[model samples]
Target: MTPPLALYIHLPWCRRKCPYCDFNSYPAPAAIPEARYLAALFADLDADCAFLINHRPLSPLQSIFIGGGTPNLFSPAAIAQLLNGIRQRLPCSAAIEITLEMNPGASVMAQLPAYLAAGVTRLSFGGQSFSIRSLKQLGRIHRPRHVLAAVRAAQAAGCRQINVDLMYGLPLQTLAAARADVERLLDLSPSHVSYYQLTLEPNTPFAQSPPPLPAADVSADMGEQGQQLLAAAGLQRYEISAYSRKEAQCRHNLNYWTFGDYLGIGAGAHGKLSTVSGGQVARVIRLAKWPQPTAYLAAHQSGHSQIAHQRELSAADLTLEFALNALRLTAGVDVTLFQQRTGLAAEHLSAARAGAQAAGLLDGGAAGRLVATARGLECLNDLLQHFDLS
Candidate 1:
């Protein structure tokens, strides 16, 4: 059986890049070419669909995620046009979950209703933090009030599932300050909360001139405190950085963690699909579009290839990739999925699992499932390193 499919649409323009962000996002121009960009997106999607048609059957879309610099930067009408075009061209599930990422600074209050009407069932706000000092230090444009206003607007527009992104480790964040931020976010009554630690990613400004972050132990305490606070508020930790009320988990991300297939359209987007080659050997293919908007648009407009990169995963590559995503979940995946998604025998992971379990990192119970111990979750990178097939 073909795996469930999801769609990821990237919008590469942000008003400003954050100091710690290394995503493929650039500053927006005074006037965004919405029409031309939309046309390029559809063309890119069409090419991918055609390729799949010749190679493998396309699965019905289980979810759609419009992510990026800030998807809310586009006008509601532009967003509506894009979604409608996608629906016209793709076979989507009846209960498909559509999500749009919005920034509080982008006057999103006025666009919430239009987004909801455009079939966007979920809204993920990039609030980052509720502390003014932290926001400024992080080079965010929005104030704390803007976050509250945006959430209220989304709620008023009848959006039932909302997510607020929060970060715990800041340049000068105190334990109390981190707790306060979580409390403020909980007060908004968001269905989902993505609380993550701030890491100084390479190639970003923060890495060059490292900020004075809290000590390692202090940062760990902050994370623990935030998790406990959210737990008390009835939000369960579904993933390393994600907490949500019952049935409010982000399906788009869940699809990714479980190794489901997805088609990605837009500049710098990545996609994965599983297919059978040689009539019997199962293979997984990875596709990526051009990283720059101009190049991507030009390729599509000139009827040239939009793909910047494409590769079929080797057995070793597939094994490593599968473990990299699956082990991040608090509730690990069924062991059967290892073969189903990677086209490898279950024995492929036996040695790695045994080593991890012996080291007290992975749980030894759940004979048919792969579950991570609390130690495994904390030292995820170390646990995953043992799975290296090279």
Candidate 2:
């Protein structure tokens, strides 16, 4: 069977990087080298295609994700050119899920129609918070009203599959405050909701000067209450931080959680692919593109990006990778899928199972899947520790 192919397009520039964000994002400059970047992006994709043409002749493109710093920063023409490049090099399926990530800031508002017409079927808005205070605290450029306006504009542009990202347990947040934010977002009736707890990641400004965030107990309460509210709002908590209306869960992410294959194309993007030959030889692969956007552009212009940074995964690597991503879902991957995806005996991770179960972090039998117990989801770090490389 031909491996499923997915493309990740990364635009590494944002209007302004948020204090809490450590993503591969940079502050946008006054003049963007759109034409140069577009040329380089296509060249990079062409190089990736040549690899497949030589070794693994895939059938057609299954999915395409235009994530960013902010894909909306580019004009529809640039996006179309990139899409056309993919179409020219490979067969693009009609059912391909083309998703674009947009920030709610006013600057991106005008590109909605062009994006929709450019074949972007899904739009995920970075509506980090509906609370104006939270927006200010997070240093978001857009206000709650702008988020509302963006959602309306996307709907008007004929985007039915919309995802609004929200955050809870923010600085000085309360359960009541968190509930109100969810209510406001739900009023927009989006197909998907991704609710993430605020984490002070290392290297982020938030980590350098830690804000007065809610306490652990308060953060937990906010998370629990937010899940309950989202469920009541007709969005099922399909994963720890993701919820969706029926058939609306993000397939691109689901592919990752289930260990499906994809090609990482842009700066800082990562991908995985699994291949089994005969009954003895199996390879579960991983790949990372270059991290610096400016460097990527330079490499793109040179006709060779050396773009792929890492591309190896041993059996144990696959096991850990599978568990790390799959266990994040509320409904975990099937037990059989563990062996199929990782090419390892599930019993190899028996210690993880026993440890998590003892810690009340895993349900002994949920769909006969190694799913996260409420406690398991909460103590994820501890649970994942059971899979240490040592």
What are the per-model C-alpha RMSD values against the true structure?
A: 1.3, 2.0
Q: Write one digit per residue (lDDT tens) for candidate 1, span 1-390.
A: 467789999999999999999999989999988999999999998888887776667668999999998898898899999999998888999999999999996468887898899899999999999989999999999999999999999999999999999998899999999999999999999999999999999999999999999999999999999999999999999899999999999999999999988899999999998885543328899999999999999998889998999999998898889988999899999998888787789999999999989988889986888888999999998888778887
Cα deviation of 220, candidate 2, in Å: 1.0
Clashing pairs in 1: none
Best by lDDT: 1
Query: What is each predicted model's overall lDDT from 0 to 1?
Result: 0.91, 0.82
Residue-wise lDDT of candidate 2 within 334-354, one digit each (tens)? Answer: 787777666677787788787
The best candidate by TM-score is 1
Poorest lDDT segment (10 consecutive residues) of candidate 2: 273-282
Q: In model 1, which regions exceed 4 Å deviation? A: 277-281
TM-score of each: 0.98, 0.94
Candidate 1 achieves a global lDDT of 0.91
Cα shift from native, residue 301, model 2 (Å): 2.5
